[model samples]
Structure formats: structure tokens, C-alpha cells
Target: MIDQSLIDLWHGFGVAFQFHNLMWSFFGVLVGNLIGVLPGMGAMSAMSMLLPLTYVMNPVSAILMLAGIFYGSQYGGAIGAILLNLPCHPPHAVTCIDGYPLTKRGKGGTALGITMISSFFAASVGIIVMIFASPLLVQIAFKFGPAELFSIMLVGLIAGGTMSRGAPIKGVSMTVLGLILGMVGTDVNSGVQRFTFGFPDLADNLEIVALALGLFGVAEFLLNVNRMGAVGSNMKLGMKDMRPSRAELKTAFWPMVRGTLMGMLFGAMPGTGPTITTFLSYSVEKKISKNPRSFGTGNIAGVAAPEAASHSKTQVDFIPTMSLGIPGDPVMALILGALLIQGIQPGPQLITEHADIFWGLIASFWIGNILLIILNVPLIGVWVKMLRVPYKYLFPLAMVFICVGVFTTQNSLFRVGEVAVFGILGAILLLLKFPVSPILLGYVLGPMLEENFRRALLISDGSLQVFVATPISATFIGISCLLILLQLLFWLRNLMRARKVRESAGVPT
Candidate 1:
């Protein structure tokens, strides 16, 4: 299989570098980055909006363009999150927890450099895995029944619950709150309207862009309104500022490796996307760190891990999308539609039947990634120059962009209003010392988690044992339990130490 893939890849490089195809890849990557930079603009939106233009091209060129749009956007999303404390995409929300803080410390260029390096490394790892292990990953994804999927999501939620610095319960409660808010849309099973109090727009569920922007962007806007001068005060854009130190590079290496592996796994799965993988990466980095408390602060590892994971996941998304012909989400659905329109069938025989198309797309990944590296590095200076602009003037421009971006999501004023509401909610949570990110994780994962959980139960005739019935599911469940146990032990040890200190001090015991 490996030998055959090598032959196919060589042939693919031939087809992908055809002048027109190569140009499209560059164009796609450039457009993708632009889409990512704009708040609320996703690759799905960009592709859908631009897909009409692709209809005139041959199928392979179209696929290459769309594929570039899909993953290349991730490269730019980190820039917004790290530079402006605005997460243009949900996966980028995790980047903000540390990436933004690094920017605040005049390390924005270094952080961006790290994000680019980590993203490229992880994406290369993912692409290599796809080349070598696409078949294996597709099989693994099939093994994940709804029960396994539910178990994995549970692990993510549990890990996210413990992600905050001082307050696990606060994180957990925010997660629950997010889950509850996630339930606001109509229940898919019963078609019953939920939490949407006579407003028709709620039936489709909360927009992730609105929720994320509200929490990170608008909430920060409100909190820092008084301290406007402090925002981006440290954005010094020297050549040296853009490069990571030896110590920082060393710290980032392992997390990037771990995140790349995690991203590869999640990316290959149909239902589990970049958002979950990035969230899990953040948690894993925090867990493995000697000083976990430094995570929410400006830890370079935090930036490295999740950025690697998100970009890696984006690259790996190609596996299931191309191999299984399964569109894990709406973005891939469009690609699948493009395939059908091109009169190509998607199945296990995809690579064998359409070697040119498959191989060409793979080759485009390599080219697109190269293009992105060339495209983004110079932009670092431009983004840094923007930082020289004062926050007071900058934020209003951000607000206009946010409003325009959200409004474009569904062409509704209602969505823009939703951002304001969530902004207020996020502000309240922030002011009260609750970590708002777990809520976004819950909100992002909740609906999918509930759907899979219900589907798993339904498959087992409502038997709860189904979750642990399979070895795969059981292993995931065990991992989740182990993580919880570790957290419990940590908490208990802290409790005991605190009690001893209080007793010795003669305070109320």
C-alpha cells in the first residue's frame, strides 16, 4: 500500500503543478487566509460564496481550490486571536487564552512566528499521516460508534472543566451553562422548540461565531474599555521580536508533537473536527506542563499546542472527506457536492478510481502549505504595524468588522443582536472570575455530544451500558475516568494541605 501511494503521489505532483492548478492553489490559500482574518468568516462561507466561480473549472482544479480554502483559513485565524484577542474561528478561541496574552507582552510577532511554525510542522505531520495512514485512520473512525464518539466528547468536556487556573468548578459550571445554552435550539429528535422563546431564528441553534466573538471579542472590549491604553501597548514589531527564543522553542517542541498527533486522529474522524481537537490540545498541554498554572497566562506552549492541533486537524480533514466521501460537516458537504457535480462517486474506491483527482488534491496540500508559509510570514510585519495603532481607535474598527461579519453569517440583524447578548453574558462571567472558554467548548461540543449520546442510546435500546460495551468506547471512558481521578487527587491533596495550614495557624478549622 505504501509503495502504491508513493507512485500515486509522484503522479499527483505532476497533475497538481499544472500551471492553472498551481495558480488556483495559491489563489485559494490567499483567499482562505483573508477569510480567516475576518471575524466570523469561515472557509465554508468563503467556498460556498465562491463555489459558483469554480463550476467553470475542471473538477480537480475546483477540488484543489476548495480544499485550499478549507484548511488554509486556519493559518490566518490564529493571527486574529493572537494579535487582537479576537478569535475569528472557534478553534482559535483556545489560542486566545495564551496567544493574546503573549501579544499583550510585546511578544505578538514571536507568538505569530510560533503559530506559523507550529502550524506548518503539525500540518506537515498530518499530511504525512494522511499519505501513510489514511486507510488506517478511516478504519479507526469507523470503529468509533456513537458510543465511542460520546465517550470522547465526555473526555473533552472533563478535560476542559479542569483547564482554568484557580477554579475547576467555575470552569465546569461555565461548561454546563454553555451546554444549557447549546440546548436552546430545537431538539433534533422531537423537533420541539427549545429555549427559543417565540423567536424563529433560535430554531437553527446558536451561531458559534456569535458565541465565540461575544465571549472573547466583545467581552474583552467591555472589560478593557476603561484600560484602552493597555491593549496592544506592548506590540513592538522588531525583526528580533518575530523570532522565538531558544528556550521558548524548546518548550514548544513536545506540545507541538502531541498536538499534531491528537489533531491527526481527530481530523481523520468525520464528526470530530478542528474545534474539539484544538480544545483537547489546550487541555493536554496544560496537563503535561510542569507549571500548569502558567497555561492561561502567556505560555508559548499553549499557543504552540492548539495552533498545531487546529492546523493539523484542518489538513487531516482531507482524509475522511476524500477517502470515505463523507462530509463530516457542512464544508466538506460542499466538496462532496462538487464531486457529485463532477460526476465522480465517493467511496473506498475513490483513490483507485480517480487517482488523478485524489493525488492532485494531496499534492495541492503540499503546495498550498508552502504557499501559506510564504504568504503569511511577510504579513507579520503588516499585522505588527496595525498594532502600533492605538486600541481605542482599533477596537471600533474591530466592532464594525465584527458586526459586519456576524451579519453576513445569516444576513440577519438578529445574529448581531445575539452577539451583544452573549457579550454581556461573557462579561458577567469574566467579571465574576469564571473562565469563559469552557463555555464555548461546551456550546461547540454540546449539541454534537448530545446527538451522539442519544444516537448511541437509541442504538442500544436505551441501555446505558452501551457506552462501555465496546473496547474502544470502554478505553475512552476509562481515560476520562482517569483524568477525573487525577484531578480529584490533586484537589484532595490541596484540601488536606490547606486544612493543615489553617490548623497550625489556629484559624477556624
Candidate 2:
């Protein structure tokens, strides 16, 4: 199977290596890097902006470019986080902990170098996993009925809550809120409006583009503005400072490998995203490190681990999205949407029917990673300098691009307004110290969860026991239960420890 897949992938490379495909891929990397360097611009916004242009190109070339944009920006995102203390995307947030400190210590170039090397290594591993594991994963995907899917989605939601930095209750509430917001549009099953509030445009549904822009872009802009007064004014990178020392590389090497493995596992799981992968990788590295106290400082391992995991997950995310048509994230959903528009159905038959696309996409991952390594490292100085651009000038341009992109999606101003509203909501959530990632996760997965849960209920005639009847579903439920129990125990132990500390201090418990 591996050899056959490689042969098919080579056939795909034959197509992807063409002049037009290569050019688009380059264009995508360029655009993605620009967006990634700029604060607040995410992959979804970048993809949404480019979605229309794809109609004019060959579907294969277009998809290759889009895929490049998706992961290429990841390389750039680390630059912004490390140099500017501004994370362009959510997953890049973890990099800020150590990356920015490295920059502050005049090692911005070194941080960028380690980030590039680690990302490339992790991406290579992830792409290999995608190529080999997809077939088996697809077969298992086929066995999932609606109930099983719903169960999986529930597990994802719960996992997101458990992963939160704040109160689990708050995370759960936010997820529920996201679900309620997701339900606001017209119901597909009954064709009845749920929460449109008499708005004709909204009767169709809230556009994910608008929401994502508002949440990530607009909200991020506001937050940046709030901190503008204290932000660093200079962005400079010396050539000598950019290169990592032999010791730095030696330290980061194993951590990168560990992060790559962790990312591959998590990314292959449905509904998990790079944010979780990065956080988990960072925590794991810290736990196992000889100098764990240096984690949040300027530790090179801190930068390498999360950055590698974040990039690796991009490759792994395609596994479920391509094979089962179950989008692991919003970006995957957009890719899946593009596949559908091209008249290519995603599932088990996808590999057999469109071998070229499957193999081409897989091969392109390898090509794109090579391109990113080539383009990003030498240009690290240029990207580091991007932080010098004033937020006042940069943010307005970003908003313009965002508005134009949102408007262009459907040629509607209402959609642009929707983006603004969501942006405000995102800002408020950020101010309240609430996590925004779960909201998007919930919104993206909510409808699917509902559809699957209903389908399972119908199949079982409303008897819930069917969930336990299937071996796969039973296993999923069992794992979910165990995870919940473990988390509960951890929480209780922490609470008891806190009470004991307070008692020791002679404070009221």
C-alpha cells in the first residue's frame, strides 16, 4: 500500500510540477507568508480571499496553491509571534511565550531559524503519516454512522473544555454559546429560521468567513490597539544574530521530534486543531526538560516544540478531511468545500476515483514544505522587519482587505457587516479572558454533531443503547468517560491542594 501510494503520489507530482501548478503554489506561499507576518490575518481569511480566483485555474493547481497558503503561513506566523509579540494565528500563540523572549534577548534570527528547521522536519513527518495512514483511517471512517460521529464530536467539545486555561465551566458555556450562535441561521432539515431575527440575509446562515474574520482579525486588531502604547517600536535583525548556534540546534532537535510525533497523533484525531497540539507539545516538553524552569523564558526547545507541532498538524489535518469528508477544522472545511465545488466527492471512493488529486495533494505537501524552508529562512530578516510597521497604518489595511474579502465572497455588504459584528463579539470575549478557539470549533462542528446525533437516534428508534452496541462507538464512549473521570480527579486534587495552601497561610479556605 505504501509503495502504491508513493507511485500514485509521483503521478500526482507529475501534474503538480507543471509550470502553472508550481507558479500557483509559489504565489500561495508568498501570499500566505504576507498574511502570516501581518498581525491578525489567519489562513481562513487568506483562503477566503483566494477562493474566487480559483475558479479560473485548473482545480488541481488551485488546490495546490491553497494548500501551500494553508501551511506556508504557519512558517510566517511564528516570525510575527517571535519578533513582534503578536501572534498572527491562534496556534502560533504558544510560540510567543518563548519566541518573543528570544527576540527580546536579540536572538530573533536564531528563534526564526530553529522554528524553520523544526517546522520543516515536523511537516515532513506529518505528510508521511498522512500518505500512509489515510487509507486505513478512511476505512474506519466508513464505519462511522451518525451516532458515532456525534459521539466523536462530543468528545472533541469536551476535550476543548478540558484544555482551556480558565474554568472548565466557562469553556463549556462558551462552547454552548457558540452552538447556539451556530443554530441562528435557517435550519436545513425543516427549512425554518431559528434565530435570524427577521434579517433576510441571515436566513441563509452566518458566514464562517465573516465570523472568523471578526473573531480572529477584528478582535485581534482591537487587542493590539489596546496594547499599542507599550509595544516595542523597533524591529531589527542582524545577520549574525539570525543563525542558531550548534548548541541551540542540538538542544532543539529531540524536542522537535517529540513534538512532531505528538502533533501527528493529535492532528489525525477528528476535531482537534493545532492550538491544542501546540499547547500539549509545549506542556510535554516542559515536563520532560532538564531545565523546565526555562520553558517560558528564551528556551530554544520551547520555540521548536510548539512551532514544529503547529506546522505538523497542518499535514495531519488532511487525513480525515480528505478521506472521510469530515473537516477537522474550518480550513479543512473550506478545502472540502472547494473539492465539492470541483465535483469531487470526498470519502473512500475519492482515493479510487480521483487518484491523481489524492496523490497530487499528498505530494504537494512535500513540495510546499521544501518551498517554505527555502523561502522562509533566508527571508527571516525581512519578515522580522515587518513588525516595525505601525499598527495604525497596518490595521486599517488589514481591515480593508478583510472587508473586501468578505464582500467579494457573496458580493454582499451584509456579509461585511456580519464580519464587523463578529469582530466586536470576539473582542468582548477576549476582554473577558474567555477562549475564542472553542467557539469556532463549536460553530464548525455543531451542525454535524446535531445531524449525526439525530441520524443515530432515528436509526436506533430513539434508543440510546445503540451507541454502546457498536464496538467502535463503545470504545469512543469508554475513552471519553475515562478522560472525563481523569480530568475530574485532577481538578479535585488541585482544589484540595489549593485549600491546603490557603489553610497553611491562615487564610479562609
Candidate 3:
């Protein structure tokens, strides 16, 4: 079956490589890279902006262009994150932890190269996984009841929560806060108004672009303003500085392999996103490192691992979106929306009914990744030059982009106002030493968790025991419980160790 599918995929390349689709893929990738270079304009926004333009084209061609935009932006996002301490996209926020440090250490170019190499390798591996794993995953997805889905989401949330670097309490707090924010809109089943506070603009849900811009983009700029001189002094820009030695590449290779596996698995899971997977990849890298304490200060594995996971995750997100019609996150949601607009429904029947569309899109991932590598290597020096720009002048421009991008998202000034609201909130959280990533993870997963839970209850006639009745659901719940228990044990063990040290030092007892 896999062999036949590979043959079909080869046929897909034949279709994708047609003159028209090929041209659109190249053009789309170029445009997406430009969009990624500009902070706050995520791939979803870029695809949304381009959705109407695709209406005039054929379905396969349209999809080719949009997919190009999404995966191409993977590399472009790293540029802003490393060079300016700006994530430019949510997944890249994970990159900022070590990527910015590397940039500060005058290894911006080398960091960018690792991002490119790891991304290329990971994306290649992701495509291979998609080719082989889609059939298997979709089969399992068919067996997944709402309870199983809910249980999986629970573990995902817990895994994300425990991965925080600072106080675990702060991470959990932010995640809970994100869940509250996710509840701000009207309920889908009951049609009841939620925490909207009478604001009609939130009748659907909070805008992702607005939240991301304010939390990561605007808040980051505000924090940087006071430290402009220090930021400027740290960046060393040149071609030579970008190259890494044999040791660095060798160290990052195995981490990249591990990160790719994580990305392929999590990225294919419904409701999961690259941001979470990147965080998980970073967590895994730190966990396995011989010198774990060196992670945040500037570790190449830190840069390679998360970047690899994020890039691969972006591509594999298409697996469920294309195979089961289950979107992993908002970007996949938009991609799904685009297919619906094209009068195509993606599901188990997708490959059988629309073989060309399915295969063509798969083949396009390869082309887009290649084009991105070709574009990215040469653009490293140019991206590094951006660091030399004075923050005093650059930040105001960033604010303008944030405002404009938010407004364009919904054609509402109200959404722009939401940026200020979240910006202040994010700034406060940053000052309080809270982990902001959990907030995002919470916000993204909260809706899915609720939807799945309700669906499960409805299917089981409101019986609470239904969650444990099914084998898959029971397995997931059991795993989630075990994971939480293990984390608790670790936390308690650390607490006792700290207490012992304090007692010995006579500081406190």
C-alpha cells in the first residue's frame, strides 16, 4: 500500500510540476518569505489575505500556492526571532529562547544556518512520515472517540505545562488563564454568551493575530526599548560569523533527528501546534543534554532542535488536515477553509476521491522547502543587517505593523484595540516572570478540549464513565494520569532537596 501511494505521489509531482502550478509555487513561496520577515503577520494571516486571490485559479494550483506560503514562512520566521528577539510567529517564540542568545553571541548567521539545515532535514523527514504514516494515523483516528481525544488533549496540556523553565506554578497559572480567555466567546452548542462582557466583536472568538502580536510582538518590543543599547552592542554582523564549525554541526545532528520525530508525531495530532511541539522538543533536548544548564545561555542544540521540530511540525500539520480533515491549529483551519471554498472536502475519502489534489499538495511541500532553502541561505546576511537597525526607530515601525495587521485581519479597529489589551497583559505577565507560552497553548487547546468533551458526553448520553469504557480513551486517560503523577513526584523530590540544602545552610528550616 505504501509503495502504491509513493507511486501515486510521483504522479502528483508530475501534476504539481506543470508550468502554471510550478510558477505559482515559486511566487507564493517568495511572497510568504517576505510576509514572514515582517513581524506579526503569521502564515494564517498571509493565507487569509491571499485566499480571495486564489479563487480565480484552479483548485490544485490554489492549494499549491497557499501551502507554499505556510511552509516557506518556517525559515523566514527564524530570521526575525534570531536577529531581533522577535518571534514573528508563535512557533518561533520557542526559537527566541536560545536563538536570541546565539544572536547576541555573534553567531546569528550560524544559528540561521542551523535553522535552515535542521528545517530542511526535518521537513524531509516529515514528508516521509506523511507518506507512510497517514494511512496508519487515519485508521487510528477512525477509532478515536471524543473521550480518547479529550484524554490526549489532557496529556498534551500537562506535557506543555511541565516543560516551563521557571516556576511550574507560573506556567500552570498562565495556561489556566489562557483557558479562561478561550472561553470569552459564545458557546457553539448552547448558543449562550460567555465571557464576552457584552463586546460583540468577540461573538465568534478572540482573534489569534491580535493575541499573538500583542503578547509576543508588542510586548517584546516594549521590553527591548529600555535595553536598546545593550541589544545593539551584542549583534556582530558578517558572512564569516554565520558559519559554524564541525563540532557544532555534529552536536546538533542527533538532536535534530529526535526533534524531527517529535514534530512528526505531535504535528499530526489534531489540535496540537508547532509552538507546543517546539516547546516539547526543547524540553526533550534539555532533558537529554549532558550539560542541561547550558540550554538557555546559547546552545546550538537549543537552536537546532526546536527549529527542526517547528519546521517539521508546520509541514506535518497538513497530514491530519489533509487526511482526516481535522485541523491541528488555526493555520490548518484556514487551509481547510480554503479547500471548502474550492468545493473540496478533505477526509478519509480524500485520497481516493481526489488523488491529484492530495498528491499534488504533498509534492508541493518538497518543492516549497527546496525553494525556501535556496532563498534562505543567501538572505542570512541581509537578515543579520536588520539587527544593526536602531531599536528606537524600529520599534515604532513594529507597532504600526502590529496595528495595521490586526485591523486587516477582521477589517475592524476593535481588533486593533484587542492588541493593546493583550499587550499590556503580556507585558505584565513578562514582568511577573510568568511563562507566556503556556497561555498560548491553553488558549489554543481550550476550545478543542471543551468541544471534544461535550461531544463525548453527548455520544455517551451524558455518562461520565464513558471516558474509561473505551480502550483508546482509557489508555490515554491512564497515560495522562501517570504523567501528572510523575511530574508531581519530581516536583516534591526537588522541593525536599531544596529544603534539605536550606536546613544545612541555616538559612531556613
1 or 3: which has the higher TM-score? 1
Best by TM-score: 1
Q: Tens digit of lDDT per residue, candidate 1, span 1-509?
A: 88988998899999999999998888889999988887667776788788888768888989998888877788878888988888888889999999988888778888998998898898888878878988888988888889999999999999998897777888899889989989998899999999999999999988888999999999988887766564565567665677888998999999998988888888878967678888999998898888999998899999999998887887788788877877766777888898888889888899889998988988888889889988877777777777676668877888888898888878899999999999999899888888999999899789989999999989999999998899988998999999989878988999999999999999998
Local distance difference test scores for all models? 0.86, 0.77, 0.81
Q: TM-scores of the models, in the given order?
A: 0.97, 0.76, 0.90
Task: Report the candidate with higher TM-score, 2 versus 3.
Answer: 3
> What is the per-residue lDDT of model 2 for residues 153-243, given as tens digits with 9 covering 90 to 100?
6766666554444677776777787788778877877889988888989887787667765776677678777444323344456656666
Stretches of candidate 3 off by over 4 Å are 228-234, 286-295, 345-354, 506-508
Summarize candidate 3's per-residue lDDT along 1-509 as a digit string, tens digits: 87897799899899889999999999889988988888767677789888998778899999899888888777778887887766777778778778878878878788987888899899998888788788776665567667887887777677667566687778788889888988988898899989888889889789866776678777877777765553545566666666678898998899999998888877767777787788778877876688866876778998899888987888788888988788988778988988999899988788889988888888988998889878877777678777777788788887887777678778899999998988888888888888777777788778888999999999989999988998878987897898778778979999999999999999957
lDDT, model 2, position 174: 79
